[model samples]
Structure formats: C-alpha cells, structure tokens
Target: MLANPATALELDHVSRHFDGRAVLSDISLSIPAGKITCLLGQSGCGKSTLLRIISGVDRPDPGGRVLVGGTEVAGPGRFVEPEDRRIGFMFQDYALFPHLSVADNLAFGLRHLSRPERRERVAKVVERIGLGHLLDRYPHSLSGGEQQRVALARALAPRPSILLMDEPFSNLDQGLRERVRRETVDILRETGTTAIMVTHDPQEALAVGDMIVLMRAGRIEQVGTPFEIYDRPCSAYAAEFMGPCNRLTGLWSQGRIETPIGAFRADLDMPDGALALACIRPQALSIGPDGQGISARVMAKTFTGESEQIDIMVHPLAQTLRMHSHVRIPMGIGDKVSLQLNGAQVHVFPEEPGTDDPLDQS
Candidate 1:
C-alpha cells in the first residue's frame, strides 16, 4: 500500500465538559507527523475523551480548536464530520464486522469508489499486512491477533491521513499482546502513519511511542520522549505514574534533602527547612558489601524472570524498600545487606501539602 502523506495534529485549548463537569481541560498539544505519540495516563484521565475530540467523534467546548494539517477541523463556527476529517479510528475491540469476510470488511469503507478501485485497495492493504491467507475467513474464525490486523487493514484501506487507536491491544493476553503490539508498531512505522494511541500502560508507551504525552486528571502533566519522561519527571505524580518508585519524605536543608536512608542532593527549588519528597526507583538501588552503605535485611525475594525483586527492611524506615537486581544475589531472607543508591536516579520534588508521608499518596 502506498504511504499516505501523514498529517500533523494540533489542539488549541481543547476542553470538553459533560453535565457541568470538565473531562478535558485546556489541552493544547502538537502531534508531529509520521510518528507514534502515546497518550498515557491512568483511567479517566481524559485520554480517550481527548482522542474523540480530535477525531471529530465528539466536540470540544467553546473557544477550543482542533487542527489537522494546518486546517481547522473543529473550532468556533467550524466543524468537520468524522467521515469528512479523513481520520481512521481503531477501537479497543477491533470492531470487525461479524457477517462480512475479511476481504469485504477491508473494502467496506471504499463503497464510494468504483468496484475495481475498492478491490485494488483491499488487495494492496491485505498484501502489505500479510493477511492474504485470511481473506476468505469470517471474524469469528480469526484469533485475537488476526482480528486486530484485519481491523488495522480495514482502517488503512481507505488511506486516511492519521490513525487514532484507543487501547488497541487491551483485548489480547499478556504474551500475545506484546507480540501483536510490536507488530502493530512495525506496520505503523512501515506505512509512515501519524498515530495517536491512548494507553494506560506506561511500559507500552515507553516501548512504542516516539513521543509520550503524560496526562493527569484532565490536564497534560508532562510531554517528552520516553527517556525524559522516565528520567526527569516534572512532579512527584509524574514520577510515580511512569513507574514504581520508593518515595521518602525528608526535610530540605543546606541544598540537600535528609531522608531515612541518607542525604540526597536536592535538585528542585525548595526553601530551606521545607518538606520534600525523594523518588527512588527500585532499579536505582543495588546490593553492596556490608558496611559499604545503609544496612538492611532482606525480607522477601520475587523472581520475575528478567530480574529479581528484593524487599528489604531498612532500620530507619518503617516500610520495606524494594530493589530490582538482574544478577542473582547470594543472599537469603533475613540476610543483612548494604543498600547503595544511584545518585543520578534519585529525584526530589516539593512535598504536597497535607501529606505527611509521600508514599501514602495514591
């Protein structure tokens, strides 16, 4: 299939309200052409709602605008229907027609074209997606992954400018989900399709997205490449949302924050003697020889195939600290070990008011 010229998407203060409550608030984002941009956040963070507004499935509130390829699709006194916007939408369920065969389903959107043109379009998409063998099969006869590919082919058959996927791989099992998700990303890249995918999984966003837009409670929390969002989160909420972190409450003093483990350099702006929170990822902690760092006793160990998660009870803190080790540690439960922190991975942020313990939030 010939690659469609990718179109960039722009949202200008796009806000959506329902029954006097705001679902999306002041969302202004510029999605680059021919790249996968993942809309990442927890459930009800307005990721899907924002996608709907951009696709013309729903409308934004007054004064908000949505532009596609430098043309306003939705704004004050101007609105384009979803079909007229030339956008392809792949739903969470794949949404393949139950009665139609694979080939017919792929050609469903090409009804306006001549019969030969529709057949040629479907053939091109099927060949590109390697779905030729399943052309005669029905939706009920296909596996989850096959159904997903069919839905993708159907969406791409019309050669839309941009593709919008909402939790595309949520239906597949863990193993199949990983493989299918990778294949889907490869196809998108191969076709040079500009895509905006909504997913609640941080790992999915980190793995497949060229750019990640982290959303929170109807607002964009952070936007950057996967590394930036993971390494240099803008806030405590952003830090924890991307991955699990061992949060510690401490007092900022003399350009450093003193915690239960030790004093870490405070890179954030905080007044002297003010409360701050330190976010340390499990991968940042390592096991070293006794007396080299803070003393801790191994409370539990979980083997996760790629790495072993060790829970250690620190003397200064009431809760246990979790650490991930790729190499098998010659340590057992109740064994005393020294825990060393990688200073580069320790992030400090101003503590949220009314929260005594940073770990207690959420």
Candidate 2:
C-alpha cells in the first residue's frame, strides 16, 4: 500500500513544449489527498498533456517541478522514471495483455512479492471488484465493461501512490458507461486513493469529480468544486463550456444591466457603460404572465426528450436578441411568449477588448 501523505500531488510552474510550440503554459495545480480531481477541456486544450506529465510519461520543461506526496519527482537536475514514481495509469485504451489471464495480468506488478503473497493480493482485488469467478478468464473473453473493471483491479492491485485515468469509460455504450462510471467512483471513494481523470464531457466531470480543473488554450480556466464552477463561472467562455446559455449584450450601471428584454440586476464592478454579457442558463428562463415579462416571438421549437428548447427573438431591445430557453410550454412557432429569468444566481462577465459579442457570430 502507498504511504499516507497529507498532500497527494503538487506542480510548481509546470510547462511543456514541442518543436518551438508551447502545448502547456506555466500550469500549477495542488491536488488534495484521497480526493478525485478531474482535468476537463476540449481537444488540444493541454489536458491530456498535463496528465501525461503527472504520470511521468511526459516530462516538463526545465525549471518545472512535479511533486508526489511532498517528494520531488521531477525538477531541474532531478528526474523520476515512470515506474519509480509509483503511479498507476489507466490509458485511453485498456492496454490489457491479450495473452495473459485476468489473474496473471493483476499479478504483473507484484513481482517483488512471494508467490503466495502475489496470489493473495490478486484474489483480494478480484473479489473486491466482484470478479473472482472471472479471474481465470482471458481479456478477449470478457465484455468491455468487464475488461474495464479488470483493468481497474490490476491498477489498484499494487496500490500505487496515485492513479491517472484518461477517458477511461469512453469505449462503452452510454448506458453501460454511466453504470460503470458510478461504480468506479464509488470504489475510488471507498478506497480513499488520490485519483485524477481526464475527460471532455462536462456532465461526466460534474458527476464524478470532487474538484474540477477546467482548462482552455493550454491554460487553466477555472478551478473549483463542480457546483462552484457551474453556478459561478468566471468568464463567458467558462460559462459556455459548462452548458448551453443565452447571452445578452448590455450596458452595466448601478449593479444592473439594461437590456431589450428587461432591466435585470447584475453583480459587477465595471464602470458605467462598460460592455458585458448577461449569461442566462437554459433552465433559468420560466414562462411568466403575459403582461409582466419580456415579450418574445418564438422562432423555433425543438422537442428534446425531457424538456422543450424554445428559440425566441426578443424584440424592442437595442438589437434582436436570439435566446434559447429549455422549458415545458405547449407553444408553437410564431407564438408570443413572456419569459422571466429566475435563478439562484446570475452570471455576468466583463467583455474583453477587441472581442465580439457572443451572439454576434450566432
């Protein structure tokens, strides 16, 4: 078993480059012990590269440092091989040995143990995963879900200091993927092992991560709990990444934003007349009384399984505001509806210089 350290991982000024291009800028993160942290971002966003560096499969540039359990693993004039770091990695592909049985594969990392000790460790893990009956089976004979469990079992068999997973459940069908994900998170929490997972799916990150590290363009965008990241994104880009949103362009003044739809209260410290985005999440709009809310003409309506997506054009504003609202309304195209924004919180981001409005390109 790995030693219990107060801090599981820390990165100090970590950066990576390739062929004169910087793939990861100076990124530093402190991960807590026995917690699940998710590194989430779109493609080419440097999430996977960061994971590789953490696992010692990729090295950071000079002057960068990586520490595991408060021990310096990588730094100037110091290096730790991937195997010496005591990190367990579950690659994008399972990377299981087709020629080896489940038991042998689980026992692969226990070479230092005696034969009896190896068997005992493997048995304990296999039974913990409820797969003892399949221990003698080969990888090819198992289903994808079963194979995933076996890979997890093998990674934990040696009980490394940290575990890294890259798109671990993307290979399975959606239904099976959710089930496996729930079970995997349960096991991780139960074992109290520090773990990090890389994923592009925001919902998946929210569902499984204790803390979320959102990245973009080779930099950290936001770091917080799932609730904090989703409920209070710091920027328009960060807000859009979490889910669909309806953005309104308006002038900020006196803690309120004046828009064509209506004057809504906003919390911002920007000077008066500064441009900003009033981000309304899809679920924030509710159908209000006909005479008391913003007037809109329905342009389109899409029926998603659980709720309806109603596209509206808010007239009488400085510009025609295209808005999307996910709500239940038995209305059709050309229908006139009133919408009132209601949420526990409202998000407003100051517009950047030289940046176009979010809806301008829509």
Candidate 3:
C-alpha cells in the first residue's frame, strides 16, 4: 500500500432526489488527500445514499459530481459505472459470496491483474487482516468479525484509491467493534488509502475518521475533527446527537447565562437579555451536598465508576438537571442536592423562534 498525495476527493453541490423527495441537498465538501472522512448521521439521514452515489451504484441528478483524484466520475446526466470508477465499497452486511472461500473472495475483484500479482495481493491483505488461517474456509464458517475483515481485505485487494464502508462494523459486538474499529483505522493509515464511511455511531465516526461530517435530512450540518465537533457543536442537534450533553434554556446576560441551576459566566460572548440555550458536557459539571449553589433534589442516580450521573430536580423552576460526579455519592432518589457549573466556558445557541423542539424541521 503506497501513499499517494495526489489522490484527493471532492463533492460539489451534490443533490439527489427520488420520487419528488430530496434525499440530499446542495452538499459540497472536499476531502483532503490521503485522509479518511466519515459521514455521520442516523438512519435515513442520506449518508448511505450519498455514499452510493459516490460509488457510482446510484446516480444523482444535475450538479452532483464525485471527483476522485481530481477527475469527475459522476455528474449531471453522466456516471462512470461502479466498476469503472475504481472505488472499493464494503457493504454493511459484509456481502461476501457464501460459496466462495476467503481466498477466492479476496481475489474476486483482482481478475484484471496477473495471476501471481493477484495471489500476492490477496495473501498480503488476508494476512494483514488476520484471516490467514481461514483463507480456505467459506463465508458461512467465519464469525461476524472475521467476515468483516474478509470483506475489507477483498475491497483493499483491488488497490482502489478510495474505500467506502457502509456501517462495516455494525454486526460486531461492542467490544469487538472497538477492537476492529481501531485495527481498521490503523490498517487504513498504514496503507494510506483514503476512505469515506457512513455510520450512525458518533463514537465510531470519531474513532475511525480523521474528519467527520454530520449529515441531516440529506444536508451537511457540520464538518470538523471529532474533538471540535463534540466540544463545540454548531447546532442543538449536533450537540445532542454527538454525545451526552445537558442542554438548558436560559436568559443570556452580559457574558453570562442564568439557568435553573444558576448563573454562570461564558467565554463566548452573547447578547444581553437574549433567550438562549446552553449546552454543557456532562463531564464539565460537578456535584456536592446542598450548599450555596442552586438547590435541587436528586431524582435518580447511575454509577459509571469513573463518573456517576446524578439526575436532579431543580427547585422553584422544577427543571431536571443532570450532573456528573467522580465520587460515589450515596444520595438516593428524592434526596436534596445542589449542583454547580465548574467551568468558565459553555456553548450557547440563540433560542429558535417558534416551537421549542429544535428538531421540528427535521
């Protein structure tokens, strides 16, 4: 696997519609050469649809063009057929031929190469993926993770410039998913094979991709590195969807916000006397016994060892505020407690104009 700095991918105004409904709208982004980008969203968010269009399995209408290595492979009324596009795709279900042996499956797309070259490539990728001993076994005899690796080896064996994975690790258990995800990224980096993958798991996207693009209703909501997107989300949806966040509605004051919990200064400037919604990561909060901070009652508790989540019912306001604590607080349900914001910065968004539900349009 050779690194090619010349292989860059770009999508320009990509729009796809089906049966009078738009699946993707005006999507545009360029993937850095030799970098892995993940399309992240829940089911039906159009991530998979966009991946298909890029793979040339599905074509989009005018303005949708997938360029690989700076060459247009798909565009208005034109599409290079899937095989001709030279883009490798790993299906969600593994898609390994049931009757084909692991070695045969890995060699399926290498028909265009010399016999010796194909064998060498298959042997190398199979060994790299740790499927060396099962090369003669059929797909039915392999476990879910092994099957996934087989699919990956087959895709990589073709030496495609870009690899498109559709929830490739969805079938694996949680522990297996973590191990395989890390291994997969390491292999991709070692090979320097640029990739674009679709997954709903934010953790997976963060772990596997060098950059993550959050998609909603076929449109890109935000694009950034995992830490940037998680720490500084651009929207309420991104904040909540990416991880556990405590979103609170409050009135913004001069460089501060007054919420049910209490008033806290923010680093990001906000207009005074404006309605705003503040987002605080769970790990940013601290909890203790009733004290000078805003008063609340512990409604529920869940211990996560490193941190325990304390759900509290705030007084007067009656809003529930959940805070995180590192200690094993013995507070049970209905116990009085108080919480405080332990940080100097929080992310806030202008309250949406009508309905309180931020996802009304979604």
Candidate 4:
C-alpha cells in the first residue's frame, strides 16, 4: 500500500538489463495524482524501455517495484500482467486496427465489462474526443488526426487510472503536431488523468508536461518544471540539451570564469582553480558595434523569421560564436561587432567527463 495517497504512480529502484547490458540504472520516481509528467531524453536514453517497465510489458531486474494507487503491481516477487494493471497505453503509431471500425476499436478494451457497459463506455469516449461522426469509419479511411483520436478514445474507454503515451504525435507533420498536442493536453486536463509521455523533443516536453524528468545515458539527470529545467539546469548536459548554447571553459576563481570573450561571473560553488564551463544561450548574446562587450567580426548572417543567426569570430578568442539577435543590425561580412551577454540567461556547470563540450586548454 502507498504511504501517500496523493501519489498516483510510483517506481522504486527500477532497473532494466538486457544481455548483460544495463539499460536503466536504479531509477526512482513518484508521480503526483492528476498531473501530466513527461519522460524526456534523447534516442537510446532508455526512455522507451522505462515506459515498458511502467506498463508491466517488461519486467525489471530483481530490485524494482512499481506501484499504482498505493497497490504494488510489480516487484522482486510480485508480478502483474499489462492488462491487469489497468493502465492505458498509446503507441507511437497509434496502433489502431485497420480492419476495425472506430467504435469497434474503442470498445475493444471495454470487453471486461458487460456488453451494455462496453457500448456505453465506448460511446462516452467517442463523445469526449468529439469523434462521434467517425464511429462507423475504419482506420484506413480516416486521416492521421482522426486515427489518432480513435486510438486515444480506445485507450481512454477503459478509464485506466494512469495513461502512458510513447511519442504519440511523432507521425504527424509539424503543423498538425502542434494542434494535436494542444487538443490532447486540454482533454487530459479536463479529465484530470495522471499521464506520462515519453518523448525526445525538448520543446514538446515543456509544452505538454507539468513536470519533466530528463534522462541521459540511462540515468536520471534532473527533474523539474519547464522553467526550472530550462532556466536553472542542474548540469552542463542539461543546459546544452535544452537548447543551443555557446560553451566556454575556464578556471573557477572568485565566482568568475576568465574567457577570451572576457571573464564573467558564473556563480558556481566549486573549489578555486577547478575547471568549469559557461553555457551562454544564443539569445543571451546581443550584437552592437559601439557596445561595452566582447569585440568580434561578423562572419555570416542567416535570416530566420523574427531573428537572424549571427555567426561571428571573436577577435580576442579566435573562435567563431553563434548568436540569435532580434536587433536588426545591418552589418555585412567582416564588419567589426561587439557581443554582450545577458547574465540572467546564461548557465554554468562544473566540468564533467563525457559532456558535449570540452574547455580549450590551448
């Protein structure tokens, strides 16, 4: 039994191994009731494998336990089948049977109920998704969006306590994806369902999840709200993965890192003279000629919608840096410029092995 009723889903010391390879390492997480949580990570980060463990599709290595609504579903000795767990799952491909009608597919999971109860449950879900008119249609005859709705309705018809979605909108084009994401979020909120989605896209995770669990190399890197993860990243890997940033390495001294661009205060708690790095997001750098900042020369500029990407070569650093600036400074190739850093937008982390960037020692 759960010690806290407010938690809808909980995983304790979950680990998965395949053929002597560890895919997940002692993962533990507690999901509060009625909130959407996103499991975010890059490809091969073991997000999908973790999702499988949560749904009881794959058993975890010996020292693991999964709990739903204070009831133990899987653990070192206990085991629960996927269907018995009463968890709804939405696949990457939507997984709607082409031969079945929309109504039939929605009713499939409701088979455990009486015939009348199944029909009523299916009808309710169809209405909830606003797909009443498409009930008689087959998956092959429906558009991608329609098929996606049908799949969602089918999963929801069972009214599982928790919903698990794996890359649910990856198949749709960019425009359709945004719309569907909004719709899904709205419905999940209206129903007050606890949901966990596995996604590789950072933006999607921020937009869809109330809280995000970032993973890397089969380990939990950090867990926080979107603003907390993006603005206050806990590691260099977390900072870079959230968005593009210019990395600079320097000796940690008096709360500042000396760089070719000039020493800037990074506010990190590290031993003096230890190697550390600064993560400056593109948006943090502003370009101006007579500005009090780092001296640089514009190498190239690529206009991208509201802002232009400025490729600049720092005169003192001799390293080309990229910045995105909204200020329309008309400067051609080889034009001297000054780069300014917005301290509020920058992030700093201690030197860690296997990070995407290494400080230039030379």
The estimated TM-scores of all candidates read 0.95, 0.92, 0.91, 0.95
Candidate number with greatest lDDT: 1
Give residue 125's lDDT in candidate 1 (0 to 100): 95
lDDT of 2 by residue, 273-342 (tens): 8887777776776655456687776777777676677676677554333334445677678877787776
> For residues 106-195, what per-residue lDDT tens digits would candidate 1 score against the true structure?
989999999999988998998999999999999999999999999999988899888999999999999999999999999999999989
Report the lDDT tens digits of candidate 4 across residue range 156-214.
88898999999999999999999988999999999998899999888999999999999
Candidate 4 residue spans exceeding 4 A from truth = 356-362
Flag clash pairs in model 4: none
Q: Of 1 and 2, which scores higher on lDDT?
A: 1
Which ranges in model 3 have alpha carbons more than 4 Å from their true place?
1-7, 264-272, 353-362
How well is each residue in 301-321 modelled by candidate 3, as lDDT tens digits?
A: 888888888887766655566
- Error (Å) of candidate 1 at residue 167 is 0.5
lDDT of each: 0.90, 0.84, 0.82, 0.86
Output candidate 4 Cα RMSD: 3.0
lDDT of 3 at 27: 90
Q: Write the number of the candidate with greater TM-score, choosing between 1 and 3.
A: 1
Backbone clashes in each candidate structure, one number apiece?
0, 0, 0, 0
Q: Supply candidate 4's per-residue lDDT for 296.
A: 77
Least accurate 10 contiguous residues by lDDT in model 1: 353-362
